[model samples]
Structures are given as structure tokens and as C-alpha cells.
Target: MGTQFWVKGTVLCKTGAQVVNATGPELDKFIGKISYGLFHGQRLKQCGLGGRPFRFSFFPSLMEVIPASLHISVIFFCSVLIVFSSVASAFFMYNAFGSPYETLHGPLGLYLWNFICCSCSCLVMILFASEVKFHRLSEKIANYNESTFVYKTYTERFDRSFWIILFTFLSHTLNILLIRLAGIQFPFQEAKEATVNTGASDLMY
Candidate 1:
């Protein structure tokens, strides 16, 4: 009698079939190559049990998706949004503790505004970090490897939070642009000239 050794495992596929039979050696080699692919940030193509092949691609980094010429503009806008959001959040927090805002808007309203601004700022920061750090790429790899094999080339899309933060930022930027377009100066600047004239009139008197 001859002895035989057979190692068996399941190959997960996203489409067509859920489970396919695979040998231990094949699974080992496939997993080894996948580890290397993940380390080098490379796409992987592997064949499943039934001779079905699947491709896995990582999500492109932000810079890859964005043009170099517009890089500075993007950075500038993100920074401005972050700063303004932080400042607005702080202002709201301060008002939450005080008299006029507490009486008029109430603590809840002030706190709500504060939370929105703070959350928007934090979410923007996280998005910026993910852009540089390839966090989404890692996530894609994990998701594809979990219980299903991803077939198509991975495409990166902005999440809802990203759009929300972007819209908020753009709205604030538009407000500033409109003020400048309308030739509106700060109240302090308008008061400065009045103060100077009043001082001169007092001197004359």
C-alpha cells in the first residue's frame, strides 16, 4: 500500500464562487507572494482552485491621483480649512461658557457648533494623513484578503466625511472671497479711520 498526503484549504473569491478547494502548498506559496506584494505595495495576481485568476490592486496615493501643479493649492486649501475650523471650534467653545451666547443660543447650540467644527477639522486631518501614509491601501489589502478575492483594479473614492469637510471648507473660502470681491474690510480697519478723524477733530476743538 502507498501512503498519500493531501493538504486542503479554501480559496475565497468575491464573485462567481465563494469557496474553492486549494492545497496547503499552493496556499502557502500564494500567501507568501501576497505578503511580499503587500510589503512592496505591488499588485498581485493569483489563480484559484478552479483555474480562475483574480487581480488585487492597491488604492493610489493622493499625490498619484492629484497633479503636481495643483499640489500646492490643495495643501494651502487644506491647511486654511484646518486652521479656520480649529479657530471657529475654539470660539464656539469659549462662547458656550459665557453670557450672551449662553442666553441667546444656549449651551447646546454653542456646543453643537463647536463639535461640528472640531469634527470637521479632525476628519480633514485624518484624510490628509491617509493621503500621505497609504492607510487606504492597507485597508484595501485587508478587505480583499479577508473572505473574498477582489477582481477589478482597486479605485479610490473620497468618503462622505471627505466631501463634507471639503464642502465646509469651500463654503468658508467662498465667504472670504465674496467679502474681498465686495471690497469689504474688517470692522477694525473701518473704525481706524473714524478714530483718526475723531482724534483730529478733538485736537481742533
Candidate 2:
């Protein structure tokens, strides 16, 4: 995730210094032009109105300047998300193709894995957002090792990658709901109902 800044000022004052206006290229200057991009794994590329576009990595180059602990935590949770997603997939296949056990290998297991992935997805978003917003990530990246004029954030926002993780979290949550809607009772609920039925049968006998 990253931010973009306008290369030039938008407003222009008339000779009387009262009327202000923007026209021509100035009106569309910021359109589809990214000042820079801080992507996941990919190079931090530069593109926009002026200067030659270039690329660089966040690791080793801007490592010290960025929040290492929070960044690493985000990465760690993302990895956990991936691993659990795969585990959930495997369990789904097992449930479909083979005779699975009741507790950990049945529908309950699918719910458990999906819930774990959802938690990991949430953690990834929180940690990354905290590292970005609270840590002033964009400004830090823009001003890293520069002796020139300080760079202020003209615009900042969470990019598509961040939104993708958010969608992943939602997908996991929906998967949980779908599992419940498929008529699979929660493990604890099934146990409690079975206990109640047994008690009622004993009373009748």
C-alpha cells in the first residue's frame, strides 16, 4: 500500500489575485499518474509527470527506516493465512473424498481452519495498517535518506493489496456462514443437544 502526490500545485490566481482557476493539463495532471508505489514483494516503482521512473526494494534499502517488527508481523500473519488456507483446502478435499472422523476431520475441522484463516487475515490487516498509518510509512518512504526538501503526504491510502486481504477475510467469514447454512451444527451445539436428548430419554425410561 502507498500514496500519490500531485507533481505541481493545482490552483492558479489571476492577475487581480482574487480569482483562482485550473485548466488544461493541470486539471488532469494527477489522473492515472502515481508518484510512487509501495507494493508487496514487487519493486517500489516511480511513475508520474516528471523524472525518470525507477524501481527499488524495501528490504535492506529502507529496512532500518521502516517499522521492522510490525512489518515482519504482518508478513508472518500473511504466511500463516496462506498455510491455513491450504490446510483448509486439503481438509475440504478429504471431507469430500473420504470417510472423515467426527470432530477434527469432519465439517468441524473445515470450520476451524476457515476461522483460523479469518483470524490471520484480520491480524495481517491490523498489523499492516498500524505499521502504515501509526508509523507514518509513506512519509518515511518518501523522505528516506534524502537531503533535499522534506516530502509531505499529499495523499495516502491503502492500496488494492490491502483490500484484497480484506476481501479474503470476508471470504473466510462467508465460508463459515455457508458451512453453518449447509446444516452442519456446531460441534459444541451438537454435543449439548445430544446430552439433552439423552437426559430426556432417561427420564422417560
Candidate 3:
């Protein structure tokens, strides 16, 4: 039988990677430059994962974004939370007329449930992404033909999942500070507010 083989996967590493073999010193320096940025100073703009930067008039100021990216599920949960809280608040206002004054009860419960669900879902994504193997060029080449399963890098695979989780966590802990500093503006009012008046805004005000 003729030696037959099926080429699999895209030609990523083949793009001059194999041609330019590096020496020990060169390789070491290259590795050092990888820049995890998990704790870097100028690692704000992720380049192109989720949000991109623009000028509202070239205004000079500082903005700190969640270095991470977000998934639909996480984002959806947050959005739903906003909706839930708003509806609940409105419902609370509705009952102020002459009802039991407990109208905030239902929306409050729903918002809580949505918040928990969103949080748990986000956690699951982060854990799952953390477990993902952010391999090197050599590793991908090793499994070049295991299956036609072409996936993005650990970075690309989850589309900034790491940053998403990190930023999301930070947003929770340092929400007020973030707003005050105005370093970066991320939408977290729903989650943050839910944290306090979360007690069913449907009642007081």
C-alpha cells in the first residue's frame, strides 16, 4: 500500500515557524517576552477580544476595563439581572398604591435567582476555561492529526474568558471605587445595586 496520509488542521505553525528555528538564547528571550499580563501595568486594552477603544473626542483621561472578555451567557445573565431588578422595582412601585406593600417580594425573588444563576454560570465558564490547555506551537503540531478538531488558542478558545472572570470579579468587589475613579467604565449597576437595595427596590423607593 502506498504511504497515504491526510493533512489536517490549518497551516498556522507552517507560516514560517518551522523554517525559522531559534537557538537557545533566542528561544529563551522569545519565551520571556510572552507577557502573561495577569499583573502587568499596561495590559488594559486586550487589542480585540470583546471591547475596542474609541475616542469620544480624543479626551485625555484614564479608563480601566475588565482585562477579560465576556460570554453570551454571562452577559445575558447580567442583562437579565438589570431587567429583573428594574421590573421588580417597578412592580414594587405599583403595589405602593394600596396593595400588601409586599409587591417587591416577587421581583426581588426573581432578581435574586437570576443573579445567582448568572454568577454560577460565570464561575463555571471561568473554571472550565482555566482548565483549558493554553499550549505552545509544538504541542498543537504534535496533535496535528488526532482529529480535525480545530480550536482557537486558550486565549481565543474562550474569547477572553479569563479576563471576563477577572474583571467581573473585580467589578463586584471594587464597583464603587471603579465608578468613582472612573478609570474604566463597565456596566455593572444592576449587579452592584442588586447587592445593596437588592432587598426588593419594589418597596421603599
Candidate 4:
């Protein structure tokens, strides 16, 4: 979450034709590439004719410029993803190498944990994407603390880190299918079968 970014994009703005002091007419263009990740907030690389190319971090510096509530929500879901993924891993390890309970610590537990991790990963991607698109995140980050010029999103796309979470979701889904392939009945199916067997035995008695 902290290492890589979910979305990367560039913002551009064109300066006004005339200046107040007026050395000469000026129409300059500015462009900045911004990358937004979970923990590190956003990164900006300014490459424009108006100023020397530079780089900066947005969090704690321009933190107020972005939507705080939605950002926090993304972070929350990512944290949940990490926690539940770890729990699912531990359950897998125990189911393979250690003595497990018949129900909670068995196939049912594995399914439950994997499902949770999958759900959280999905939510992380959805919420982060929503924050970027609906909130106009790129434009906000580009225009932060800038009074002289306004910036517009020139290009935007999801980065590798975002797809990594998607792969994580797929992996959990695969694990669930593998559990079924191992000939273990789903919890509900197992319960229905047990109830039917019990009723048949009662009738025989």
C-alpha cells in the first residue's frame, strides 16, 4: 500500500498572455505528473516551461487540498485487506501443517477468511477509484497552493499497485474454488446432507 501508487496522471495549465508588471506578453505552459498511492499520498513531478522541473510529496504538505474523508476510507479498506489476507494465510498454513478443529478451523474457516480478504481487496479498489474520478483528485492535487494558474487533468490511468490488489482478489477467489475441487462440500451443503441423513436414520429407528 505504501510502496507503489494506484493511479498515475499528468496535469497541465497554460498561463495568461499578459502580466501586470509587464516585461513582455507571456503565455507559458506547465505540466506535472502526479502519482497517488495509499500511504504516501501523492507525488508530483513538475515539468513545465514556467518553472524549473521539480518533485514533491503531497501528504502533510498539501494534505488539506484532497478529500480527507474519502482518502481515509480507502486507507481503511486497504488496512482491512492486509489484516484479513494475513489471517487467511495463517489459516491455510495451519490447515496444512497443524491439527485443526472439525468446523471453525477446518474448511469452513478457510473459506470464511479467504472470502473476507477478497471482499476487502475489492472494496479498496472500488473506493480508491471513486475518490479519484468523482472527487476530481488529479485536478485538485495539481492546483494545490497555486494561485496564478489552474490545472486540468491531461492523462490518467490505474498503475501497477492497483492491479496488484486485483490479482490478490483473484488469488483468493481461486483458493475458494480449489477448496471445492478438493472434494470438500460447502458448509451449507454439508449441513443439508447431515440433516437428511439424520432424518432417514430416525425413520429407520
Candidate 5:
């Protein structure tokens, strides 16, 4: 949240002068409406979860749903997808129970893999919706946009591997097969050249 210290500071100062030099002076006055904006702007402090300083992505206008100006279709689609994936993972994990313990080799490997993937995917979806920059409680209170704090908290992913490892985690499980239905492929084997007989290929072939 941010404070817009913009007030009509001009008419308070210039009375009739505004009538003659209305264009230039009026523009200056318009700029001065939020003179304190730059002031409060400097008071930025990084507070809460991630510790990275967050100012509002944009100065709040009269709109409350400014940041979420997402098309309902997009929101609805992603929301449904997230919910479906979450439930599917849960159902798969619950149905495909595995060994209670792990060894160097085992039959419950699928179960273990499913458990890992499900856990990681949930963590990632939570983090994907989170932000590293956090809102200071004071700032939120001042700007009246406390929800921004929650936004950052929800989408706080650290890096790509976090997601990759998450899917890789499930790749070992039945969810991997389901994800394959979605056309997602997880790398398992590394491609290698056929003992690239460099000398034989060039000289004999």
C-alpha cells in the first residue's frame, strides 16, 4: 500500500492568478496535489516475510481491484486448473498407498514418488502465487491495501528448480503419468552419442 499525499495545494495559494496563467500554473498545481507522494515514497521499508522491500506495483487509483485486473476467463481457468491438479494429486496419493519404509530398492517406489511430487507441487503452487517483496504492516495500514501482503506471501517461489524438482518428484509416481496426459514430460535418461567412434565414422564410413 502507498500514500498519495496529493491535495489541491494550488487554489489554496493562487486565487485569481489561476485565471490568467491557468495552463502552466494549473499543471504545476496538478503535479503538487500529491507532493507528499515522493515523501512517503522514500519512507519505504522492507518488512514481513521475504524481507524484500515492496512498494505497491502501481499507485492506487480509485480502483480496489487494480492488481487483479485479470480477465475472469483467465482467473477462472487457472483457478479451476489449480484446484483440479491439487485434488487429482491428493486422490492419487490416497489411492496409491505405498511401503511404510524406504530401502535402496522397493516396490513402493511409486508411492514414495507420488508423495514427494504431491508435496512439492502444493508447495510450489503456494509459492508461485507468492512474491519475494513483502509489505510492511505499517505501509499496508497506511495505504489501506493489506491484501498486497497476502499476495506476496502466496507467490513466493525461489527458483525454477523448485518447480522442476516438484514435477521430477511426481515423475517417479503415477501423477507423472497423469501429467503426461497433460503432455508434460519429465527428463529421465540422458541422451548420449553411440560411442561416437569419431575415427571410425570419418575414416571407414
Candidate 6:
């Protein structure tokens, strides 16, 4: 055979892991600034998780999910309550001085307060509904889009009064429920019964 050279070699390789530590003031500062909120800086701390990586669950609890029909019925009931309360309050306030017998005496002040509250509640609800329905319509209008408008419009601003009215309505409704739950009859009911009895007695006489 002619001069031929063959080379065969075995190579051994070693793998090693490296550890890096991230501990510094900069990292700590970054973590401190990370937070979650409905609005900026209004951090919501719940369920032991509050940070940039917001942890959210669609159904956090079983009670949160309700049937659509039941939900609609509840909303309807609430609407009826708000409407009836508002109407009653307005009627009582309008006839505040006209009829003492029709309007409960001691609770006249209460009715006046209720009137003010319910009026405000209705106004707030109407304003909100209008905003939702008419805001887009207004936006499509040429006049409303002008940059030179002098005064600010109601649609442009969120009135804090809305929240006030909402809370008032909620509390008013709750009070009514509480009264019913306690089995306490309204003064108006007693007045009506008394009037009926008096009329019967007069007829008998």
C-alpha cells in the first residue's frame, strides 16, 4: 500500500450552569412602582395580588354568576322601585302644604327629604341614560364638533352628583326594605284605615 495516514480521535465535552443574582435598589424601585388600578394610582389590592402582572379571574366566586332571566327580573324590580319611590316622593312634595290629612304629619319633613333625594336620583339616572344614548348622536353633529365652543357641555363632564344620587337611592331603597322586613307599617296606611273607620262610623250614626 502507498503511504497513507489515518487519524481518529475521541473528544469529551463538559456542560456547566451559571447563576446570576438580581438584587439591587433599581429592581426594588421598579417592583414598588408596579400596581393595578381602575384608574391610575387607584391601586386595587385584593386577593393578595396587586401589581403590574394583574391576576384576574372571570368567575372569582360561584355567587357572581346568575341566570340572565333572573338578572333581568332583578333589574326590572329595581327600576320599578326607583320609579315608584320617585313618583311618590314628587307627589307628596307637590302636595306638601295642600293636604295635611293626605300627607303624614310627622313624616312631612321626611317626605320633603325623600322628594329632594328621589328628584336628584331621577335626574341623575335621566342624565346618565341621555348621555349613553345621545352622546354618539351629538358627536356626529357638525355644530357640536366645533373647536370654538365657549361653555362646556354636560356630556363632556362626569358629574359627581350622579354618585350622590345613586348612593341616596340605594340607601332609600334599603331603608324601605328594612322597614318591610321589620313588619313596620307606614303612617299613610294607618291614616287611610282611620279615615275608612271614621267614614263607617259616620254612616252608622
Give each prediction's root-mean-square deviation over alpha carbons: 15.7, 9.1, 17.0, 7.4, 18.0, 25.4
Q: Write the per-residue lDDT of candidate 4 for residues 65-121, one digit (tens) a residue.
A: 777877888788888889888877865775666653432324456577788888888
lDDT tens digits by residue: candidate 1, 125-175: 454445433533333443344454544222334334444555675665554
Report the number of clashing residue pairs per model: 0, 0, 7, 0, 10, 0
Q: Give the TM-score of candidate 4.
A: 0.77
lDDT score of residue 139 within candidate 5: 22
Q: Clash pairs of candidate 6?
A: none
**TM-score ranking, best first:** 4, 2, 1, 6, 3, 5
| Model 5: colliding residue pairs | 6-33, 6-34, 7-33, 129-154, 129-155, 130-154, 130-155, 130-156, 131-152, 131-155
TM-scores vs. true structure, each candidate: 0.30, 0.68, 0.27, 0.77, 0.22, 0.29
Model 3 root mean square deviation, Cα atoms: 17.0
Candidate 5: stretches off by over 4 Å: 1-54, 57-74, 98-205
lDDT of each candidate versus the true structure: 0.38, 0.57, 0.33, 0.68, 0.32, 0.34
The top-ranked prediction according to lDDT is 4
RMSD of 1: 15.7
Q: How close is candidate 6 to the true structure, as a TM-score?
A: 0.29
Instruction: Report the candidate with higher TM-score, 1 versus 2.
Output: 2
lDDT assessment of candidate 2 = 0.57
Which stretches of model 4 miss by more than 4 angstroms? 16-29, 41-59, 99-105, 192-205
Q: Which residue ranges in model 1 land beyond 4 Å of their true spot?
A: 1-126, 129-133, 137-153, 186-205
Steric clash pairs (candidate 4) = none
What lDDT tens digits, residue by residue, belong to model 6 across residues 1-205?
0011111111111010011222343222212111111111111111112232223221222113323233234334345546656655665455456664444333334333454455555654664445324542112221122253211111233234334446777776665554445443454565544533334312111
Worst 10 residues of 1 by lDDT: 1-10
Provide the lDDT at 114 for model 4.
80
Tell me the lDDT of candidate 1.
0.38
